[model samples]
Target: MVNETMVTFQGWIGTDVTDRYVGEAVVASFRVASTPRKYNKLANGWVDGETNWYTVNAWRSLGRNCMEALKKGDAVVVHGRLSTQVYEDEEKRRFQTMVVEATSVGHDLNKGTSFFTKTTVGAGGEADDGALREFNAELGIGGPQISSDGQALGDFVTDEPSKEPAA
Candidate 1:
């Protein structure tokens, strides 16, 4: 038997990411501040409630990428699993802590502009590839017709048109 789990948490980074190497794989760890609100009916208003701090850990390529891009105070959306562990200190006092094992992480839009790089993968229809190739060629990114498993699509294009009177 097997069980699968998924969890999403949105919060601001409480500190800069710390990166280290375990054997050959690189890992990054950081803490995030999450504020959950509560409604106070008696006061007839919403209360600025307690803030929970969560530690997030990312491994391998993701860790390296995050170390370069993520920073303190950056709002991020993290998808992963929750883990808790208990241990006894030297004084024999017991304590338990919770942390998240982040699989995929990205900056939340409220923090900054979102940049998306589109890439087409798998074996789609020939027509689709042809059209993609035409667009890619016109845009000068290898005529999207042919693509490897991890080939980069192209540059980012803005949907917003120039601000001017249409002739």
Candidate 2:
């Protein structure tokens, strides 16, 4: 069975992303809203049609980037695998959440300008033999010996927050 569906969209982020550790895995989640806008001949301006919202799930370092880079109302581009999450509330009503397992996300330059840097994970495009490793070395992303407990005498439990990708 072939059930995977790939989707790509450009829109505005509807929420702030916070990255957290979920059992040794870094995860970040946020929402992206897309609406079809067209010129309204009667009003002579752009008119928005119905808005569609999708929950974006970014994993690992890409997830970390989203946490540091994005905020509500920032225009962005996202690409992912489409999936649905079904759940029931205390009232016994079932709801299906539209979700996208985001593989790539970036600022929509059409709306505004932004800065970008290749991540330690990868270059995001086709690989060309050791390029990603070299990029990571330049940025100092993956390094050794930063124990959380030892850093602040067992008070600090998490790594330092990241600040990049201006909103």
Candidate 3:
């Protein structure tokens, strides 16, 4: 990693995040579009420059978090290792694409405010419901309701009846 290129990009999500299992490890892939703007003294206005696109890949827990938290059009900052991928088409034309293997990805707080939720993982790499329950209790909120089959029914206790249709 000493000589490898590392870059930080601030851009808008250009495509939906897609996550899939690669041999038991999850990987999320998405595209980001970055456009540079500059102020022109003569024009007395801001000038938009050409847009550059890059593909980003995040692995493991980061991948899962990205799949849940990111959406198209959201402003985000991505920091990662940069590399180039080359391919040849059927017509014998060669193309190169920039790719970022993301180490950190987060929303641009300057753009808007966001809520933070801490996730607790158990020893087995599963969510720890006890931690969530304790947090909810501390906040004076009810914890999630779990079904007999181990599925979460609701996030908080509600006085109103269920709106979902009975299965």
What's the CA error at residue 52 for candidate 2, in Å? 1.0
Better of 2 and 3 by TM-score: 3
Superposing all C-alpha atoms, what RMSD in Å does each candidate have to the true structure?
9.6, 14.7, 10.0
Cα lDDT tens digits for candidate 2, 60-167: 777877877889999999999998899999999999988998999999999999987544443453223365346435645434322322232222323765544668
For lDDT, the strongest prediction is 3
Off by over 4 Å in 2: 39-45, 121-167
Clashing pairs in 2: none
lDDT winner, 1 or 2: 2
TM-score of each candidate structure, all chains considered together: 0.66, 0.65, 0.75
After the best TM-score superposition of candidate 3, give how far the Cα of residue 52 lies from its true spot, in angstroms.
0.9
Please list the residue runs of candidate 1 whose C-alpha ends up more than 4 Å from where it truly belongs after superposition.
114-167
lDDT values for all models:
0.75, 0.77, 0.84
Tell me which residue pairs clash in candidate 3. none
lDDT of 1 by residue, 43-100 (tens): 9988877787888999876787688788898899998888776899999999887688
TM-score for candidate 3, residues paired by index? 0.75
Clashing pairs in 1: 133-145
